[model samples]
Target: MNEQLTPRQLMILVAYFIIGTTILVVPSALAAEAKQSAWILQLAGTGSGLMLIALYVQVFKRNANSNLFQINERLFGRWIGKGISLTIALLVFVFCAQVLYYIGRFVTTQIMPDTPSEAIHVLFIITVVVGMRMGIPSIARTAEIYFPWVLLLFIFFILFIMPDIRVNQLLPAGEFESMSLVRGALQVMSYSFLPMFVTFASLNAAYDWRSSMAKAFVYGTLLSGVMLTVLVMVSTMVLGPDNTTTQLYPTYVVARKINVGNFLQRVEVIVAFLWFILIFIKLILYFDVVIMGIAETFRITKHAKTLTVPVGLLIAIFSAVVYPDYVYQQEWDNTTWVAVALLIGLAYPIALLFLSLFRKRKAAAK
Candidate 1:
């Protein structure tokens, strides 16, 4: 039985995945370099991301019925394609660990200070693994089910926080250093856009991959990008660039400032809840990518579900060691992660698409 995801489900998944880790820390990441003009950098990054999606659309058009692993095998041939697929699986697995760590660290630091991050990692991955076992349709349906609540909470978040948005805080905008803006934009793409390459792993499951899928990808990305830009601008406006850069999760801190009539107080939980949903969806999606890639590469579909728990355990363990300290994670994010994301998310797809075109031309010539 083939599982099918609707275009709407795909759109929601893409938006939630792109907004995953980005909405929480993007303010600080952008403000650190772009300063008062971080929102502008976000807009730039979003634009760049949209353009990159065009390239993915081309690749998808070439093999609308094949998942990423199958495409790799088709384009690169059996041995080389399987090797590349395995590498992708390994890389995504590492990223999955990092995201798990992010969730664990966030909960322990902001909400449950005394709780062990490892504990959170284990618990969270257990849930994600369960989702994986249910398959893509179930996962997408779950996202659809939660979409309206997430939207409602987001509206409330913005409405309440509007009063605290001081125009003076963004006064020094447009005075950004060019290199700083470039760096900030790259950071945003690394976290939000580049990682979207993972979506290709599931696009084949979409009911309308050729037409509606492209529209879904474009719209979903635009929605998330706008949402992220708003969050960054609001954070900078309310928290100031200095404070925004200093805090680990600036958007969460901004949520603390939302108070309506002093009656609706202590609503930072809204931000936490939002982050939890986005992060979980993103994490599970990445986990699915890892599973599908490995299963396809190794011809282990029969045992994929049974291996889910062990893979989840490995992710939980790796989350502890992905970075020794928070400082190291930040450093890696600013430097190493951008390069890694570009290599897999940008270079890999472009190479695949070009090779595919060449192969088609050769066949046509024959």
Candidate 2:
């Protein structure tokens, strides 16, 4: 059971988790709101994310012996704790489905406009199920091996896109409104960073010591934050505020702009490859969490391999029907989705932390 995610492994896990679909879609989402200053909002969002990780680490320290489910049970009584655990399990399930939906959408719009979405969905699910059956150690090790390559390509893409950057495009400083920038940052924080709470389920891989937990969460969040900011920079500088806001995949557009010579045309292939790696890792992690949550819910400590298919099938079907089309998906993510994530992702863990601390104080006073 001790996959024992090293600092290196945790950092990559978190970087993948944060960057996933957001890098593809968020520039448009943020630009639609904050315009030229979206990169500045991204910077602020990263700081907000760092604070949230600090909060999560504190909860982990207080409930050192418990996984997320056990922590819920300890914080509330049996029935209520089970209820909360079930709710979280459902959230994790929906989470995987949403990520799946993004994969389908990306493939259809960005890569192969003619390919059927369901075909992509089925193929992706097959890979995810196999990864889940193999389990976290395999997943973590695979990430360890492949993450560096993705990172290198990402760095290459950023450097590749630089010559096209128009310094004047980011000027004017949101001349119309400043509040939009604040909202933009909040959206970015919720969409990208706060979801890291999902890591609570597999946190047993973290070393038992409090500092180890801190190292894993802090380093991971910081690294992912840097990646997000770099992506925003590239998107805004190259595409300009108006075009960045209107495009479906601003970063991909930036990649498409890369052309050193006629020989190097269409190297946006690197973006596609980078995204496929990152999104696949994100989907697999959430898929694994759903299985883990079920085991914790029913106390099925033994063989939950039986649970994988039902969950995977459920997610695949749900993903297909989740959002009718790209426009609605984009709207929901910017407006409703962040609110939903905040209520569950932020609400549950912080409440659990408060209750645990209160109970600890009562015990000491007695």
The model with the greatest TM-score is: 1
Q: Tell how far residue 181 is off in model 1, in angstroms.
A: 2.0
Q: Residues 29-133, candidate 1, lDDT per residue (tens digit)? A: 889887788999999999989988898888877877778888888889999999988898899999999999899989999999999999999999999988889
lDDT agreement of model 1 with the native: 0.86
lDDT, candidate 2, 8-89, per-residue tens: 6777787888888778777887788778878778877888888888887777778776677777777898778888778777
Q: Give the Cα lDDT of each candidate.
A: 0.86, 0.78
Q: Which consecutive 10 residues in model 1 have the weakest lDDT in total? A: 202-211
List TM-scores for all candidates, in order.
0.97, 0.94
Clashing pairs for predicted structure model 2, backbone only: none
| Model 1 per-residue lDDT at 184 | 80
Alpha-carbon RMSD to native, per candidate: 1.3, 1.8
| TM-score of decoy 2 | 0.94
